[model samples]
Target chain A: MLDVADVHTYYGEGYVLQGVSLTVEPASIVAVLGRNGVGKTTLIRTVIAFTPARRGRVMFEDRDITRWPSYRIAKAGMGLVPQGRRIFPSLSVRENLEIAQRAAATDIAEPWSLGRVLDLFPALAERLRNGAGTLSGGEQQMLTVARALVGNPRLLLMDEPTEGLSPHIVAEMKKLVVGLRARGMAILLVEQNLAFALDVADRVHVMDKGKIVFGGTPAELDADETIKKTYLGV
Target chain B: MTFWIINTLNGLSLAMILFLLAAGLTLIFGLMHIINMAHGSFYLLGGYIAITAIRLTGGFIFGAIVAVIAIAVIGAIIQRLFLARLYKQEMRQALLTLGLLFIVADIAFFTWGGDPLLVPQPPLLQGAVHFWGIVYPLYRVFLIGCGLVIAFCLWAFLERTTLGAIVRAGMDDEEMVRGLGINVPLVFTGIFALGAALAALGGVLGGPLLGMFPGADFEVVLLAFVVVTVGGLGSIRGAFLGSLLVGLVDNFGNAWFPQLSLFTIFVPMVIVLALKPTGLMGRV
Candidate 1:
């Protein structure tokens, strides 16, 4: 479980995330839906300490990780697949996975190892020797996910994992998310894919202008067509 | 044919030194994005340290070890204390590190007068072997072997080890690497130190061939820049290949046309940039 409260983030002088607060329960997939440039990625970055929160606290498993460095936060069991699929372009598919591979103490049962990750994303295994940058968009996205999963993270922060993918790849990504949740991985998903969010997320928190405007079960958000149309434009 | 052979050997020797310097510069710059103008200063400092150590220890091996270790520690301190503060901003890093080069140069001059410093070759490596009846310095040949061995070892470290994997990852995306449970800052500091140590090693090995002097840092640094640029920014393979090309061209240029030698050195870089832009072995 992870807790972020009153986190304020800035890009240069302008305030981007103004006192945003949220919590993700254990083994749950929490979707944060927001319009473009609505601080969704900023929230994710702040939690992972890529862009540290100016004023707020981020707690992971009852430990205050607010001031912790990005690497320490990651070592504390948080994995992030950033907005862009920032795979090592020159490195092979296999090399990308192995690069972020660290054996932490609290690795899950049937832990996400190199072999397991490859099995989960078989396309990656097929292109093991191929450069990561040469992979298709879907393949790159899958490799990005596999790269993070190989780190054996307790809390996975996926920012727009299914973005810019074909429908088939999108469905496959949804299945992958559901499967991860079934395997008891806590995911803080920031996504623009509304129907996909509804399908995979147990709880939904709709963010607007840096604050969570809506937080409820998926069904509740689905029923509120006015709110969805107004905020998500779906 | 004999003249060509000698020129080729000279080119190889020059290439080896350039590779040693550029390999470190490329890695440190590519991974950390810090344009350390003081990188050549480390090379100069390494030579000075080796000279002093050899004087005290009276053994080349022991002296080499002392010199490498000392400068590596200094490299780490520089990264932690100065360069770390200027990450992602090349202009600031360039200005700061360039200033550091002057400071380090002045320190060396103050410590060991302005005259050219002589570095005696280890006795075991002093004798020459006749190649095509041409007398080649034993130290120069040793330097070639040392450079190749170091290059091979570096390739192995970057390709075979876990730490190297992290460095490769850090090079690809430093922020994401940090988010993946790897200590990126620690990796940055280590890489910087390793790179600095390599540059220093080149300086020590090359000191005997090219005497250690106050302006030597500037000379080597210019060569390093040309090598790195010609090879492509952030490409080790490119750096290696570029160094060979530059080394050959430089040697031949000087030998064949001494009047245009200085100008000819920058020609390959111009052509490479004009033709490939990304370099011969560089990635987009």
Candidate 2:
């Protein structure tokens, strides 16, 4: 459903995503794995046009969207669970969800509603009126994911969804990703955790420096010792 | 006792006007982070336009409405054409808006002439109301009521509505709001226009008591800056409390100790800043 063709992105003078290409079919989870500073985040940002691709094209649902602004791209069915769980600190949890509801892509049948998201994260439902800043790290991460889901996009771009969470919370996150994929939501997950990526990813792409160095099934990636040692530092 | 009561009423009336101006200032700064130095020009322009509209339409309410609408349109155009390009560049935004302040002031001077002009009070609020052996202008009391109504409406809008939720969210993390598929630029324009409209409404309302003069724009703008600074830069509730504090101090100080009036106004601000650098309700 989404295609990235030899995308090149840069952060000022530093080359980030160098001649990178990948694709995610409908209802599949494509996880990009790498160590810190391997341009994994840049690839996600490039897809969302936060860092516009300096070269190459991005096609979503058979349309060229490389030059579209981030908001337009989002409105056209791209939901971003950005790195760092950037929830609106001063706002209540309910306010955050309500704001997302305004921009939700309405064409999707059985769009993810507030009720459905609350069902997924009951903790958030209980803390609806509480300030988002007061939420714990795990709750904040859940809120971030719920915020994205409320937008009801056809494709989701999640950057390091399991970062900085405990083991149980990480397990919950993995389950959430699996659940989303089962519901036919295509997701592009950028992750540093190897086991979590292997657990949820339908396809795996290992990136290094600024390019994808390996692509295969999670089992194939796990079995390749040299590739993991060179790119991911195992 | 009567003297104190009269001065207190006068202080509250002036505070109401200040609140109207500061509310718009704080909201614009809070959401956009643009120090619109020219905001006072909209107030001055609104007063001048209302004066002309009143003369033509012979109705105070209609004149006020026209002035507000006109200034709102002007603010939206300026934001779209100029301020939109200078986001995050406070220096450029300041210079551009400062330039606008001067240009608008000059235009008002040319059109309205140099002398202070009095806004005609609405017929219903033209007389004085007598109570407890003291008298107060009915118009001034109406101004206070207007301020209260406006404060409530603004509070409700910011705290209770979906669009307001987006604005509040945008204030915290604009990039994330955009990532959520919101048209943030559109929200910005709408907010700028709303702020301008509020300032214009204040101008029309305050014209009768404050009088419209060439330098009134800068005077009120300076007072607004003081209000925003003392209340916390972006907090609307802070603006309200700050406006009342500054207003009461200015009026009561002038009544009881004219020599210390100017000093008294800054005293509260100094103390507030010393104790809480963020202003009363400011975050960060």
Candidate 3:
């Protein structure tokens, strides 16, 4: 489980996230939803400590990780499939998977080896030795998720994992997330896809202008047309 | 025919030394994106330290080992304390490293004085031998052998090891590597030390050829940059291939056409840039 409290993040001189707060229960997928540029990516980055909070606390399984370096945060069983598919363009699929393998606590008993990753994304297995950059946008997205899963992270933070993917790939990605949650991997999902979020997220937290505007189950979020229209702008 | 054979031999040997120096420089530049103007200082310091160690220990191997270890530790500290903060900023990194180079160069001048320090060869490797009816310097041969071994080892390191895989990944996207739970600082420090050690070893081996002189640091550093620029920055394989091209060109150019030797080095560089622009190995 991951917990963030009153976290303030800044980009250079501009305040990006003002006292943003959220939480994820163990083995649960929590979606942080909002309209475009509502600090969704910033919030995910702050939790992962890629963008360290200038104020407030981030706790991973009850450990105060506010000031932990990005790498250390990851080593503590958190994996991030960052905003874009930031795969090493020059590296092959196998090499990308090899690089993410750490002998962490959550890495043990994982079915997601290089083989399984390839199995999950069969198209990736076909392009094993191909340059990652040459992969289609959909394949790149799959590689990104498979890359994180190879790290065997306890908590996976996906920032707009479906952004720019084909509809078919996006559907496959949704199925993949559902499968991952079934395997009991905790995930903090950040997305703009309202229907997708409602389907996959056990609970939804709607963010607006650097603050959480609503926190409830997906059904509750679906029923609140007023909240959705105002903050999510559905 | 004999002249041709001797020239070829001479060029290959020179290529070996260039590879030793350029490989480290390229790796440092590629992974850290720091120009590391002080890398040549590490080379100069390695030679000076080796000279001192040789005098004290009275053995070439002992001196070489001590010098490399010392330089590696110094390199790690410098990266951890200084260059680590200036990552991703090219101008500041270049200026800061250049300042460090001046400091090291000044210290070398103050301690060793302006004269070229004598580096006496150990008894076993002091003499030349007749190979294929051509007399060659034993040290040059030793340099060629050592260069090949080191190059092979580095290749194996980059290709076969888990750490090397991580390094390759880091070279591609450092943020992604960091996001995967890798201690970027530790990897950076390790690589910085490795690059420094390689340069130091080259310094010791190449010391006799390029004696411990006042501006030796600048000269060798210039050559290393030329090598990197010609080969493409950050490619070890590029460094190897580029060094060979440079060494052969410089050597053959001087012998065949002394008037154009210097220009000969730049000619291939010009060609490479005209075509690739990023050099032979540069990804970005």
Candidate 4:
């Protein structure tokens, strides 16, 4: 479980997340939906302590990790699939996964082994010897997800995993998300894709101008038209 | 034919020393973006320590090992105490390291008494090789071999090992590396220490030929910089190529055009910068 309370984050002089708050229950997907530049990425970065919060607290598994270093935060069960599929271009796909492979937290029932992960993405198995950069967009996205999965995180922070992905790839990613949740891993997903987020998210929070403006179940969000248009623009 | 063989070998031997020194400089710059002005001072101090060790221990191998390990320890200390606090603050890092450069040089002068000393060669590597009427100092050949072995080891480690992948990944994206639960700060210290160790090794190796002199550190440091610049920063291949190019130019220039010896290496560097701007093999 992860709780971000009244978090405030800044990039240099520009305040990105201003008193924003959210919570992700264990084994559930909590989607934060917003249009461009609503601090969605910053929210993710703040929780992971990349662009750390200037105020408030970030609690992970009931432990305060607000001021922890990024690596320490990651090792404490926070794995990130960053916005860009920033795989190490020169490294082989196997190397990319190998560099990130880590033991799962004690709470995790079934950890992701290289063999299991390869089973999840068979396309990657054949291309393990090939360079990551040489992978197609879908394969690269798969590699990015696979790389994070290998870290054995309890809380996976996915920042726009579907961005620039094809429709089928996005759908495949959606399936992957549900499958991961079924395996008992919590995910905090930031998205601009309203339909994709609404379909998979157990709970949804729509953000606008560095603050969460709407919160409720997927059905509740579907019934509310004005909130969707105002924040997510359809 | 004889003239060419001798000069080429001489140039190559000197280039090996330059490669050892500049290789470390470039890797640090690549990963940490730290200018590390104290690098030359580390070299100078290493030579002093090496000659002293050789004199006392009566073993070139022991002297070289001591010099390397000492600098590696000192490098780690500096990284932990100073550089960790000064991350991404390039100006501050430069100023701080520049101060360290002067401090280290002064310390060496006080300890070593500003006297020139030659590193004693091992008995096994003392004689010259005679092949087809070509005479070459065995030590120069040994130096070339040493450089090549180091280069090969570095290449293999970087391209073949998992730790090397983490390092390469760090060089590409630090945030991504840290997000994978890796101890990036620890990697930083290791890399900085490794860089300093290589420079120290260069000092020990170059001592026999260049001799340990007071102002030689600054002089050779400039050549190392030129190699890094001309080869492109942060690339090992670039450093090796750059060293050979600079070495040959300097050696040939001093031999034939002694009047323009100062400008020979710089001329090629300027031309490379003007044409490529990032050096020959630099990524950016």
**In model 4, where do residues sit more than 4 Å from their true spots?**
none
DockQ metric, candidate 3: 0.77
For every candidate, what is the interface RMSD in angstroms? 1.3, 0.7, 1.2, 0.6
Q: Write the per-residue lDDT of candidate 4 for residues A1-234, one digit (tens) a residue.
A: 899999999999999898998899988999999989999999998998989999999999999999999999999888899898899987899999999999986766788989999999999999999999899988999999999999999889999999999999899999999999988889999998888999999999998899999989989999999997787777
lDDT of 3 by residue, B1-284 (tens): 78887777788887886787798888888899888888889888999999999998899899889989999999999999888887777889889989998999999999989999856577788889797778878877888888999999998998777788788888888877999988988999999999999888878888877778778788788877888887888889888888888888888899979998768888988998899887887775
> At residue B173, what lDDT does model 3 achieve?
84
DockQ of each: 0.77, 0.88, 0.77, 0.88
Q: TM-scores, in order shown?
A: 0.96, 0.96, 0.94, 0.97
Kindly report which residue stretches of model 3 are placed more than 4 angstroms away from their true locations once superposed: A104-112, A115-119, A230-233, B256-262
Task: Score candidate 3 by TM-score against the native.
Answer: 0.94
Q: What fraction of the true interface contacts does model 1 reproduce? A: 0.82
TM-score of chain B, per candidate?
0.97, 0.97, 0.96, 0.98
Which residue pairs come into collision in candidate 4?
Answer: none
Candidate 1 has which clashing residue pairs, if any?
none
lDDT of 1 by residue, B65-148 (tens): 888899899999999998888778789989998999999999999998899996667999998878667887777788888878
User: Candidate 4 docking category?
Assistant: high
Off by over 4 Å in 1: A104-107
Q: For model 2, how does the per-residue alpha-carbon lDDT over A1-234 read when each residue is reduced to its tens digit? A: 999999999988999999999999988999999999989999988998888999999999999999998888898888899899999998999988888873445455677889989999999999999999999999999999999998888899999998999999999998888888888899999999999999999999999999999999999999999998988887
Q: Quickly count the clashes in candidate 4.
A: 0
